[model samples]
Target chain A: MTKELFIQGNQACSMGAIEAGCRFFAGYPITPSTEIAEDLAISLPKVGGSFIQMEDELSAIGAIIGASWSGLKSMTATSGPGFSLMQENIGFAHMSETPIVIVNVQRGSPSTGQPTMTGQGDMMQARWGSHGDYEPIAISPSSVQEFFDFTVKGFNLSEKYRVPVILLADEIVGHMRERVLIPDKTEIFKRVAPYENSSDFLPFKADENGTSPMPAFGDGYKVHITGLTHGELGYPSSSPDDHSNLVRRLTNKTLKNRKDIVSVDLKYCDDADIVLISYGSPVRSIIETVKLAREEGIKIGYLKINTIWPFPEEEIAKLNCDDIFVVELNLGQIVYEVERVVKSNANVHLIGEIGGRLPKPTDILDKIKDLV
Target chain B: MKKEIRIGGFGGQGVILSGVIIGKAAALFDRKNSIQSQSYGPEARGGASKSEVIISDEEINYPKIQNPDVLVAISHEALLKYHTDLKRNGILIVDPDLAHMSEISEFIEKNEIKVYQAKVTKIATEEIGLRIVANIVMIGVITKITNIISVDSAKKAIIDTVPKGTEEKNIKAFDAGYNLDFN
Candidate 1:
């Protein structure tokens, strides 16, 4: 039987990770995201998984990568400053195509602006923060329940794509308490293992979808990894062709399957004159604002992106609405992405906040009223 | 229907815990939807802190309490800070000894809000023998006055939320507040 536990968002994320067969956790305690580490620290051991508190965020991601290679699903959780520390490693994980979950319970940023306050400033950071052209799979959940469900999805996506999946949650959603019904058992997604013989196994060989099946460290396969561009055999290669081929394949894997990787919860958008594009905590206020706007006889629709990156440009491109408002907790991060997609077609407005506050329903409604 | 609730007190008074218990009672036990959020920062250390909850039969979208229907204030600062935001005909639950008695009396006469009084801190300290259980006591009192959550369900939630070995005393503290003659 499924038991309903009234837990905070961070707890739900931890539970989801465990249920998704995360056997190892390595994290440095960071505010707003510390509860995830705390919960996993206690729960992982009881579930026969190993938990380690790394010295810093660099080691946190590094340990998870090492653990992933060793055949155990692993993850780490952090906030802005910690996330900044993990970016170089985030790129490394992407380059290695390691299946690991990184939960960034986002707090005020730039440099620990406000430890306990909320911010969506990390949206762009989640994608390009690692300093490369690699496409990252990141999801920003709107509610506590999705915090649980999405972490499961995050792990599955990581394993499926052979990529590092980031669950981009903000402090408000991470700290809020709500009812979460977790089932006793859930279907788990494990990485595909090698189908080739040990003698013929190639670590970096791409499948049709560009994902190379990962074998466990001791699973009768010799694997070598390097930060430099490598070919199918996993040896370092500095040749332009090898480097181009490696990076292109890495980016293509995500871009080719972008539709499957991107999902949005669309509400009343078919006939909406104005559609609001939102995610995470701001979606709550947007929902309420739509209800109020309806009472005023205004038609408002919304497209909430639970999957933040591999940005759902296609969804915005398909919308026929006159105006699309990109609402986020950060100033003009997602709006730019929306603008790039809806250029010369729809007016893309930014209803954004930096930190210390979230977008209120009335605030959005007032913006709609001005447009109407 | 949706009911907005604010449980306010000093940082150490377990104000946030009380809100979580109430939210869990309604969401987990009553099978309704409840959302709980809190105030953080420096005020949480010594001045004033609060936890806000919204319980609804339908799914909750906007989690903030714009004008709370039920207000539970356990500190002097909380009472003054939140009364202006309390809706008329709303239920205001306060610890009379903790707040300015004269201001509360004047506000009661000037406004048409229903007011319930209990020495929540005193009862928890005196009857329950633990000052921390005062928030649980406040939970009991609020549940009784508003009937937003059943005593049994709220008690179960309290037991589930508090640390082990302290459940019994917390339940007793709840009873102390529930049993108070606030009429």
Candidate 2:
């Protein structure tokens, strides 16, 4: 029998994290993402884990990073304003190659924007907010079920690559309640543990896959992880070649395996003249828009991105449609990536909405008609 | 088939809970698909609030409800505010003790909308002995009129979703709503 429950997206995310062996949570209460914290507070202790409501987003991310270093699966949840505050540590986590999950429930923003509404405005920030030459893995979930599913995958990917995976959820999916099937614990993925003796192990030493065996702190491993460009021994190395190699490897680890890193849900795009694209809440609206457009005799297909980072360039490059419409709650955040990949092969138009408002089906419908 | 329902009232009136229970009844008990979303803000005791639930035999997209097929308003402000968004000839129900019947009747008569009146608060407080169960009362009224989800399914949903230990009162409130006679 399938274990199913109707739950909000945030709660599902918290459940997925707990199921994925995430035992440590540190976060400050923020609108749109507070439910994740609330759920974790109740469940983590019951499961013999630890959850702390930190003073702010910076410390929240910092605490999660520390927990990850201590060899615990950890995560934090926050919205745009809080996410912005966590970027410095997010970059530090990237440089240090610590595995953690950051659930960013996107809300309208440049700063202190709509707190109560939904926005994908932070899409770019999730990728480039940390300010460095590094590749990031971010997943966007459209519905409540995906919120659960993608979160587990986020933890798994973060574990596999030893990097922070952002589950970029928006407010609509965060708050809405829908059915989520909770699979058996055997289906959940746990991080690989290191078995190397202290004498033979170097904390930051990498194999061919750019991932090093991670040893828990106080486990007799003399790990010296730092944010500065480091060598294989986890010690700061400022030599040009050392810096270049470190930075190049940070980007290459995910970029070289971008094929495996990207996941998308494509619908009816094989014969589509116009391919609609979006992530998060706007994807739901575009799905309906595609249906209404098809009824009006428009051959439209859609590509819903599950993985937003690493850009899913291969899929965008493969689109042979005449035109592409990229809709997002914010003004053309991911659309630029679509434009960059589609280039001259297809005409790309962006339908953007701000103030945390999702574009209506009719809004995209009008755009689809204009191209026709 | 897909049906969209909107429930509206003041903040403390359990407006959102009503939508959640209805959606849960259909999806969990009846094995259908439903999605419920609510308006977000600093809702307080007397402030207007809204929740939308879309139930479908198939998967649901477009989570927001527009031109809802059914509207249940527990306050005059809610009825006046949301009646315009109700589908033409769609079902509209309200608590007559709180909503203005003359305005609703005039609007319904002009628009050819189907309207039902229930004294949900009166039934919940007087008969069910708990005024807070008015939302459950409204849910019962909705189930009786729409039959959107089975009565048994809704009863189970009430038990599953409502706060613990109050299931009996809520079930009775729902029954009072289900047994409401309105033409």
Candidate 3:
């Protein structure tokens, strides 16, 4: 039986990570996301898991990467400013094919705009913040329930692909308390451990799914890792050809299997004329607006983006709507991506605001009314 | 029909918690779909705070309430800040001890919108000796008047969500508010 209880989004995210078999957490205290670290600090120790408060966000991600390589499922969390600092190491995780989860409880920022307020400004940052061409899995949860569910999915995707996965949650969703029905422990998915016979371990060798079987230290695999381009044997390579092949494999693994990674919740979109695209905390607003518009006799629908990065372009491009309105906290971040996928097939309008505020239902409804 | 509600009050008054509890009751107990969102400026106490909830039978598209169908103001500041956004036919529920009823009454009379005034603080403090449960009292009144969810379901939700030892006092506060004559 599933038990429903009121919980903060940050706490749910922490529990989700724990339930998903994450045994290690490394984080720095920051507003909105601090509850996650606090919860994990207390909860992880009880479950025989390890929790560390690193000196900084960069060090936090670095520690998580180290822990992941040691054969333990690991994750770290931070907000905008701290997320900015973790970018370089995030790129390293992608290159080294490290399976680690990074939770970014997004606050308002170009640079420290607001610490305790909410914003979706990090949507683009979650994709390109690391300054590279790699495709990372970024899951955005609109409700406290999805916050928990997607954190588990984030772990699964990270471990399955050997890449860093980000849980892109905003301050509103992170801090707000709501009832979330927690699934039973037996229903949770645990990661697959490395095979036996430690002497014959090949660290970077891909399985049928393109995921490398990771063997940790003390397991006697004698694995060697570096930030530079590495061969299948985990040795650094200087040749451009090797670098190109390695980067391509790392990036292609996630992009090619996007169909398996992407998840979305569609409401009344099958026969709709207008599509309202939104994610994270803003989806709640979009849901209400669409219902009200329907009462007013408008043929409107909604697409709630749960899997934000690897951009779900294929699924969005298939919508044969006359107009699509992308609602978000930033001024046209996800809207640009929506436009890229939709092209000239449908009219796309950007409904957004900044400075830790959300786009209201009336604004979205008014845009839908204008377009229709 | 879709209803957007905004409950505003000082911190520690349980205004945000009330919004969430109501949303949960509506969504889980009543089998309706709901969403709750809250905002508070810096300070933990005596700060301007408001929580918005949207409940509907169908899928909810927008979460933030621009023009709330129902507004519950527990402080004078919240009444002044959010009254303008109340829908034309919306119900404005206020605590007379914290806010001057005349202003809200005048707006109601001028706009012909419904107004319900409850001496929530006095009832909670004097009768129940649990002044902090005023938000729960207000929730009872709002639930009864709106008929959005049954009283039994609301009580069950209160029982299920409130902390262990606090349930009895909350139930008493809710009953007192529910039985209060608004006519």
Candidate 4:
């Protein structure tokens, strides 16, 4: 019998991480995201895992990276300000190709914005916050169940690609309690280990799949891990050619396989003249907005993005619609990406909200009525 | 059938827990779809707090309460602040001693609202000997009057939600409210 739970989105995320074999957690308590750390702190030790209350977000990400190298799935949870503090290490994780999950339960932002409210302003920061030429994997959950499902998916993707996966949650979904089915079984992906002999192992060397087999620190393999642009031996390299190869591999590992990495939910889009695209809490409102629009005899639909990073460009490009509405809790973050993908084929519109409030269905429907 | 409920009180009034228990009862045990969301001020206590729950037979798309079918306010300030958002002819549950019927009589009558009075806090504190269980008492009252949540499912939720070893008292508090004759 499948076990069903009525849990907060943050609790579901923590449960999913535990199911995905996350044994190490290091994070500072931050509103909107603190519950994730709070739940894991109690759950991890019971499962013979480790949970550390890091002094700050920087050390939190750093500790997770270290734990990942020490052969354990690790993660950290934080909100906007904390997410910002972890950016440099996020780039470090990218450069070093360490697998970890960072859940940013986003609140209103820039600096110390609305701590108790919801915001998706970090959508752009998730992609470009680290300041580098590497592709990132970020998944946004629309509901409590999706929060659990995508957290496991985040861990799996992080393991498969040896990169930090971002689970971009928001305060609305993080705090809300809803039904989530605890799957009878889960498919966990373990990172491939390198050859047993130390001499044959090159930590930074990319296989045909654009990821090198990872060897744990105590696995009898000599490994040199660094944040510097490194060569195949994982040693810092000044040579431009080595840097180019390493960076390209880091980016291509996920970007090249976007088809397998990205996911979206397209509803009523086949005959839709207008499609509403959104992620996180705003997606819920847009779903209702679609229903209201249909009642008014509008050929409107919605595309809920599961994978935000890698941008799901191919899916947006394939949308054969005349108009597209990108709804978000921020003043137009993901809308630019939708416009970039759709180009001149469709008239792209943005239905953005700030002040940490989810857009109401009637508000979105009014926007549609004004246009159509 | 989708029913939206909003519970409001001071921060320490267990307002949020009531919403959670209701949502849990509906979604987990009662085999209904439910969503619970909350908002509070920066202060940890003594601030206006709110918790909203939506229980539906169909999928719940909008998580927030636009106009609640049932509004349970445990504090007078909360009742006055949120009572206007209650749907026309909606059910309004409150503690008469705490919420003061006079403050809302004009508006309630204007909206054709059904008002149910119970001394939830007094029953919880005097009868159950635990003021913290007032929310549970309110939950019981809500279940009895609104018929929005099942009594058995709510009992299960209360047991699972309250602190360990306090389940019995919480259940008693719930029963006190449940068996009340509000007619």
Candidate 5:
């Protein structure tokens, strides 16, 4: 039987990771995100998995990437500063096509701005922070339940695409506790093992799905992995053709599958002219604001971005709205994305905040009132 | 119906845990919708800490508390800081031993707040033989006074939350507060 429990968002993320067959967790304790590592430390060993507290964020991501190669669904959780430190390795994980889950319970940024506060400043960072041209997959959760469900989704996406998936959560969602109904069993996504014989296996070759099957360390396959641009055999090659092909394939795998990879929750958008788009914690306030605006006879719709990366351009572009309000915790990170997609079509407005305060519903309603 | 609650006290007083218990009771056992959030200083103890919860029969869109329907202030600083934010006729639970009621008598009277003076710390230390269970005692007072959560649900939540081997004493502390004659 399924059991409903009151659990924190971070704790749910940990449980979701465990339920998704995550057998290894490597993390360094940081506020807002520490609970994830703490919960996993106690739960992992009991489930026959392993948990290791590395010295710093760099080593934490490194350890998980190494563990993922050993055939375990590995993950790590961190905040802004730690997330910044993990960028180089995050790029490596992308280049190497390593399947791992990185949960960034985002706090204030640019440096370690606020340790215990929430920030959505890492939206662009999640997409472009790793310092490469490769497309990344990021999913943000607006509620504790979504935090649990999305963590599992993140692993599924990672394994399916053979990429590093970021579960982009903020401190407000990370620290808040709510009811989460956990089922007795979860559907796990298993990575495909190479089908070729040992003598004919090409480590970097892609199947029809645009992702190569991965074999564990002791799978008796000819596997040579490198961060440098590699060919089908997985050996480093300096040839321009090899580098372009590798990068294009890496970027195209996510771009071509954007429809399947991206999801949004649209409410009352079919008949409304003003759509409010938001993700993470800000979505809660937007939902409340939409309700209040509708009660006042104003037709305000809500478009919540569940998948933060690959940008959800199609959904934003299809909205025939007069105005679109992009709400986030930072100073206009995702607002620009809205502008880029809805260029000259609708007025894009930004309701951004900093210093740990959530964007209030009253304020959001007031903005909608001004527009109406 | 939606009820917003805020529990405030110094750190190490289990202010956060008390809120967690109330929320857990409502959400897990009573089958209501609840959201619990907390804010505290960097210090592990002594600084003013607060935990806010919103329990609703319907979906809770905004996870933050606007104006508290019930404010549980267990310390002097907590009472002084949050007394004005209570809604009219809202239930206010305070520990008389830690927070002096005389300081906020004017505001409490003006707001028509129903104040319950629970000596939860005294009962936990002297009667229950454990000061750490004072929060559980306060949870008992909250359950009985507000009627937001059932006695059985609150007790089940306490058992589900508190550490092992101490559930019995914690329940005893809860009974002490629940049995207090406020009439």
Candidate 6:
């Protein structure tokens, strides 16, 4: 039975992570996302899990990576500034192919603009923030229910793909309270463990599924792992051939399995002339505009992107509509991705703003009205 | 169809809590779908605060209320800021002592929107003997006027959510607001 309860988005996130088999949490307290750490601090220890309030954001993610290497599902969360501080470690996670979940409850930024306000300005940062050409999995939640469910999916995708997964929550969804149905324990997915035999273990060796099994440290496997380019045996290799193979494997693992990582929601998109694309807190407003537009006999549809990365290109391509408007809190981040997916087949418009405010439904409805 | 309701007031006035109670009653107790969201500026204690609760029989697509069908203004400042957004036939409820209703009387008259005044503070202080419970009274009065949810359901929701030892006084406040004559 699904138990229903009222909870804040941050608390739901913590509960979701705990239920997803995440036993380790390391983070610093920051506005809009601090309740996550506080809840984890109390809940983790009670369940025989471990929670550490790290000295800084960088160390927080560092500890999480270390904990993941120790064979535990680990996660860390922060706002814009802390997210920035953790970027190097994020790149480290990407390069090392460590399975970890990072929850970024975004606030208005470019630098501490509005600590308590909500924005989707970090859409691009989530994709390209860590200074690399690696593929990242970022999911945005529009409500408290998604806040709970997506955290579980985030961990699942992280384990399945052996890459970092980001739960891109914002201030609005983080602080808001709503009813969420908690799933049963049996419904949760656990990560696939490494082989039991120590003699045959190759930490970075690819299986038929393109994912390498991770052996926990202190398991007597005598594994050697490094951020530096490594061979199949997990040892640093100076040969150019080894470097090429390691990089290609790390990148292709996510790309080859894009179908498993990407997720989205389409509402009344079929038989509609115009498509409104949005994510996170702004999607709530866009949903309102679509309903109001439909009431006025406007044939409009919506595509709410649940997963931001591994960008759902095939779904957007399938829409095959003439008019598309990508709405977000930033000026033109996700809009570019939509443009790439649609190419020149559709006219892609951008409805956006900056600094602590969300685009209103009337603003979006007015645009859709003009198109129709 | 979706019905959007925005309730705005100071932080401790129970404006946000009132919205939550109504939303819970509709979504859980009454078995109707509802979504509640609140926004407050940096000041946690005393800045302008507002909460919106959207209730519908269908799945709620939008959680934010752009234009509210029923606007409950618990403060004079809220009355000044949000009065213009009420729909043509929307209802505006306010405390007569706190808000100068005559200032927007022309707009209300022109738009045919009903404006009801209640002495929420007076009733909470005199009848319920608690000033802090005025917002609960306002919520009961608003529920009565809008008929969005049954009074019995609202009373049950309030009783279930409020802390122990305060249920009796809150029930009195609710009944006082429910039975008060609206002009």
Best by DockQ: 4
Residue A372, model 4: lDDT of: 68
For model 6, how does the per-residue alpha-carbon lDDT over B1-183 read when each residue is reduced to its tens digit? 678888878778888888888888887777888878787777777777888888888887656677799998878888989989898899899888777887888889998888888989888998888998998898789888988878878998889788999999998888888887876
Q: lDDT tens digits, residues A172-206, model 6? A: 88977777889776255566667757777777888
Off by over 4 Å in 6: A196-200, A267-272, A285-300, A355-362, A369-372, B96-113, B116-132, B163-176, B179-183
Question: What lDDT does model 1 reach?
Answer: 0.88
TM-scores for all candidates: the values are 0.96, 0.97, 0.87, 0.99, 0.98, 0.89
Better of 2 and 3 by DockQ: 2
DockQ of each: 0.74, 0.77, 0.36, 0.93, 0.83, 0.42
Scoring only the A-chain of each prediction against the true A-chain gives TM-scores of: 0.98, 0.97, 0.96, 0.99, 0.98, 0.97
lDDT of 4 by residue, A121-211 (tens): 9988989998879899999998999999999999999999998999999999999999999997999998899864798878887888898
Sorted by DockQ, highest first, which candidate order results? Answer: 4, 5, 2, 1, 6, 3
**Whose TM-score is higher: candidate 2's or candidate 5's?**
5
Fnat for each model: 0.81, 0.77, 0.42, 0.95, 0.79, 0.40
Better of 2 and 4 by TM-score: 4
> What's the TM for chain B in candidate 5?
0.98
Clashing pairs in 5: none
After superposition, the stretches of candidate 3 with alpha carbons farther than 4 Å from their true spots are A5-8, A38-42, A53-55, A175-180, A185-192, A265-275, A284-303, A319-324, A341-348, A355-357, A360-362, A368-372, B103-105, B128-130, B140-148, B179-183
DockQ of 2: 0.77
Tens-digit per-residue lDDT, B109-157, candidate 5: 8989998999999999999888998999899898889998999999999
Candidate 5: regions farther than 4 A off? none
> Per-residue CA lDDT of candidate 2, range A181-209, in tens?
98876255566666787787777767788
**Chain A TM value for model 1:** 0.98
Every model: Cα RMSD to truth: 1.7, 1.5, 3.3, 1.0, 1.2, 3.0
Prediction-by-prediction clash tally: 0, 0, 13, 0, 0, 0
Q: What's model 1's TM-score?
A: 0.96
The candidate that achieves the highest TM-score relative to the unseen native structure: 4
Stretch of 10 with least lDDT, candidate 3 chain B? B57-66
* lDDT at B36, model 5: 97
Question: How far in Å is the alpha carbon of B111 misplaced in model 6?
Answer: 4.3
